[model samples]
Target: MADAEALTPRVFIARHGETEWAKNGRHTGKTDIELTPYGIKQVHTSAKELVGAKKLLDPARLAHVFVSPRIRAQQTFHLLFEGANSVPDESVTVTEDIAEWDYGDYEGLKTAEIHALRKSRGLDAERPWSIWKDGSEGGESPEQIAERLDRLIAQIRDIQRPAMKGEKAADVVVVAHGHILRVFAKRWLNCPVDLPVDMVLPPGGIGILSYKNNNVNEPAIQIGIALPVTD
Candidate 1:
């Protein structure tokens, strides 16, 4: 049997910096909001952390770097990797698969505002009525988000396998919105998708994941998400 240590690859992911809605705890789904001044700063700080990790991950060895095509996420990568004022080849790819959850009818609304609207209509705005569960207006619930994330995870497996890279596994860094990233960690660990209801992420925060080992039952995975405050 092979030693229990050499096959895993480190996967790093970071949430985009704060948008005006994100700072105020608003439900920012598919809003395509831009980062705030403080948000730009936060992304820079998060990027610095990666620079510090260079000993273990040389820039050339980064293999792949991707971000959600949404402005907030794409901008986060730009700021983190190249200061956001200009684009760089090193951070040019943005994929739609990891974009923020689609809020449908709830786009651009604050939780407080939504709650107020609910109260005006005599609807419960607490607990179960919250968007994560029953969903809001025409939006998808957390369970739906989990399904989307699972699809993306499958894509990751194909992209990272050694054969896909022509003999070497392709390691990557991803920049994406907050909620999606949190849910991803929960799923990667094989924990229940809704389990991340307890996870909270600040702007420019990060999560790291690694495949532990593949075996008969399932793949062993490790997820390490950082909730650092930078700003």
Candidate 2:
């Protein structure tokens, strides 16, 4: 019999390149930001990384490439795909489920400003990300985002499970914003989904996540498909 270990799927994730707000420490939810010149180059490099990883991936087994609808994510995938060795029937797909966290009342505000306001209310001003439950005065609650993210992952898994079952379809790639992607990771692994989803996207930092024969809830499930940014 063939190795039982051969029957698992892999998932690749790519974070979009640099933006004006990304350069400075600012909240970038729902903001349509463009990639910088450096970001363009980084996406190219990341695409090559994706191609290199194809050595382990079966073309027939690769289900599909999923991406957030945001322009930055779209641009990132378009450019990276230019370097991919193989062509897929359907390339980039967008999911509203993967959009960035809604900051609501504090959309474009800086952390410091938000902190001041929260401090006036005697809340823990240092825990900006911890407010997922309460949400911003007018933003989305963590439970809300987590619920949607969970359903989205379920949607994706349903689509891929057929291929995964056959032994050829085993993996997919995704391009999306930082927080949403990270939060999606939390939800994908059946975690609490309470994390700030703190991830740093350098130009076009590329990472990989997997659901093969492992516990998703474990803290160490985030293994590397490509070298993660060390900063």
Give TM per candidate. Answer: 0.75, 0.79
- Stretches > 4 Å off in candidate 2: 1-7, 52-61, 83-91, 120-133, 195-203, 214-222, 226-231
Off by over 4 Å in 1: 1-7, 52-57, 83-93, 119-127, 163-169, 213-231
Scored by Cα lDDT, where does model 2 land? Answer: 0.66
Clashes of each: 0, 4
**Model 2 C-alpha lDDT per residue in residues 1-231, reported as the tens digit of each score:** 123234545566678888778777577778788888888878877665445443543344567777777788888878866534554656446777777788887777777878877778787755554554566767778888897777777766766565543445656777787777777777777777665455654558766565554322221234544332333
Superposition error at 80 for model 2 (Å): 1.5
For residues 1-231, what per-residue lDDT tens digits would candidate 1 score against the true structure? Answer: 132333345567778887888877778877778999999988887666654333332344455676788888878776666632333375446666678877776677777777777777787845435555556667777777778777877766766665332245455677898767877777766676555357666788766676544331244434443332345
TM-score of 2: 0.79
Q: Can you list the residue pairs that collide in candidate 1?
A: none
